[model samples]
Target: MTNQSNNSVKKTVLVTGAAGFIGFHLAKKLLSEGHSVIGLDNINDYYDINLKYARLLELGIEKNEAETYNNLCNSKTHNSFSFIKMNIEDREALPILFKNQDIHIVCNLAAQAGVRYSIENPEAYVDSNVTGFLNILECCRHHNIKHLVYASSSSVYGLNKKIPFSTDDNVDNPISLYAATKKSNELMAHTYSHLFKIPTTGLRFFTVYGPWGRPDMALFLFTDAISKNKPIKVFNNGQMERDFTYVDDIVEGVTRIINKETAERIQSNKFYKIYNIGNNNSVKLLDFIKEIEINMGKEAEKLMLPMQPGDVERTWANVDDLIKDYDYRPNTSIKNGVKNFVQWYNKYYNS
Candidate 1:
């Protein structure tokens, strides 16, 4: 763990889901610090492959060159970065990856993301989020990885009806399969930390929106529809609220915790911990829409819709622990975040 603060050590970091938004950014940051980085992903056409490729390109990995089937690595790279097109669900391939690389830190961000999608694709969620995560914990435990940081979600605090959800809140009542899987991840990590002494941190992310965001997220959906002069659906009759943490803020918070490992035993103390990485600022759906409108300088054709299943009425993370532990600060205002997102959207899509 000497490499924790020593930049000269240049430890290799494994970023699962490197082609994904958060993973891409975190990998790039590690590379910039002169640490060798291995970016792992199945590169499944879950969303637009182009967006994933664009993120890789930013990391100096080209898509045409990154072509690979299951259990194969494209071997594409920057001087400090390498990408492998491997799914975490492939337990066989996962341990091989951990054994082959001198991976000092492992960031598990590759789970099947999205709440509503999990409802329709329950099998995929269990496979990627549950089975896949077990594979990660197993690999990390055996590989002697220094720290394992994984993505948890605010959705796990389902039906709590609490303002600014806290880590102390009971999260056994997850409404969505996705939420349940994420909660399961935290539990699983805690077990490993207790049994095997594998230091782990699970981050409960709120609604993360920003430049180069996911296509399925509301930020992307609203921007796309408004720009095309199409009506955008407002779920829950525009009554929904979210603590939309900007991607930059989330990445910064993740980076802060990625280097440090909690060493206390779970039984003796809080060896495994979960922190809420959120904006700590909630905005109503209509207000969010208006912000997008202001940023895009285009009014959206409103399509007020009922509350969608598996969707929460509100999410606001109480980030006091984050601030107390790591001095976490989220600076992007909705107006500013939306503007940056809109700029990226127009530039990326040539709108």
Candidate 2:
């Protein structure tokens, strides 16, 4: 392990979705690397704020202390970690934060994320994902930030019959509003990178799941329902498949890419890059549930149903670019990943 105290040239990183599933883990990892991290999130009530608070609690920010928006709370546990409760779409406050924090690298993981929820609330997608991203681009442009890495999604490969989706493949056919917003983020990032020379890397994350996972994700929902002996919803009659990457794998890839020196981008005059960060293995929905069931020692009663709107049939990622550049390979198997999640779930909920 690198002794964090002896390291010089520590960059100050601003993680927008610090309270999110991936963001929390990334913030923790960066802090351990001796970088000063300024965590930001709206702490929305999309699912349960309790989970978000719990993640912040792990980052050394208490729920009561994090209630005040725009107030920076330094971490008692790690001096390098601090948090602020703020929305990315807040144009006024967001720029002020960028200026005040002197943030060099930005990881924009904040957004209204959900396929089904976007169907009824399309405006929310435009508000947070589009408008919020635009604000981030503008801030990076004006603030002279070095790199802007934002979260894209595999849903951008919507309706494509190709297996093992690649970053070079065309992503114009987004099936849902959420997918559309993610694609828009990529486009916006490229434009800013080209026009303003802000080096940007967009990660099209597969179905990421593990400990401290989001309650609305498939793995979390399945584990929660099965543990309580409630029936789990099986969409597409258990035929759907997903490239479920573990959260730690995603964080490792992001952290490496953040520090991987991008002088080549300037040499080539292309300051933009996108990569698919995934496990590279697609597992059936039913098989995934089986892993959860085995880990929990409980079988779930599944409610079989047709595929819902804004949902894809399957997702498989081709991580050749990620491995080629950053040498990122997601190594967690579904069984072990599920076991990790179940262990954390039991401890967190005392179930």
Which predicted model would earn the best TM-score?
Answer: 2
Using all chains and alpha carbons, the TM-scores for the candidates as numbered come to 0.94, 0.95
Q: What does candidate 1 score in Cα RMSD to the true structure?
A: 3.0
Indicate the TM-score of model 2: 0.95
Itemize residue pairs with steric clashes in candidate 2: none
Q: Residues 102-171, candidate 1: write the lDDT tens digits.
A: 8898899998899899889999999999999999999988888888889999989999987979999999
lDDT value for model 1: 0.85
Instruction: Estimate every model's Cα lDDT from 0 to 1.
Output: 0.85, 0.88
Tens digits of per-residue lDDT for model 2, 1-351: 111133436789999989999999999888888788988888999989999999999988888877854553332334788788888899888888777777889999999999999999999899999999999999999998988999999999998888889887889999999999999999999888888888999999999999999889999999889878899999999999999988888898898877765678878887999899999989999899999989989789999999999898999999998888877777888888999999999999995
Tell me, by lDDT, which candidate is best: 2
The number of clashing residue pairs in each candidate reads: 0, 0
Off by over 4 Å in 2: 1-8, 72-78
Q: Runs in model 1 with CA error above 4 Å? A: 1-9, 68-74, 261-269
Query: Ten-residue segment with the worst summed lDDT in candidate 1?
Result: 1-10
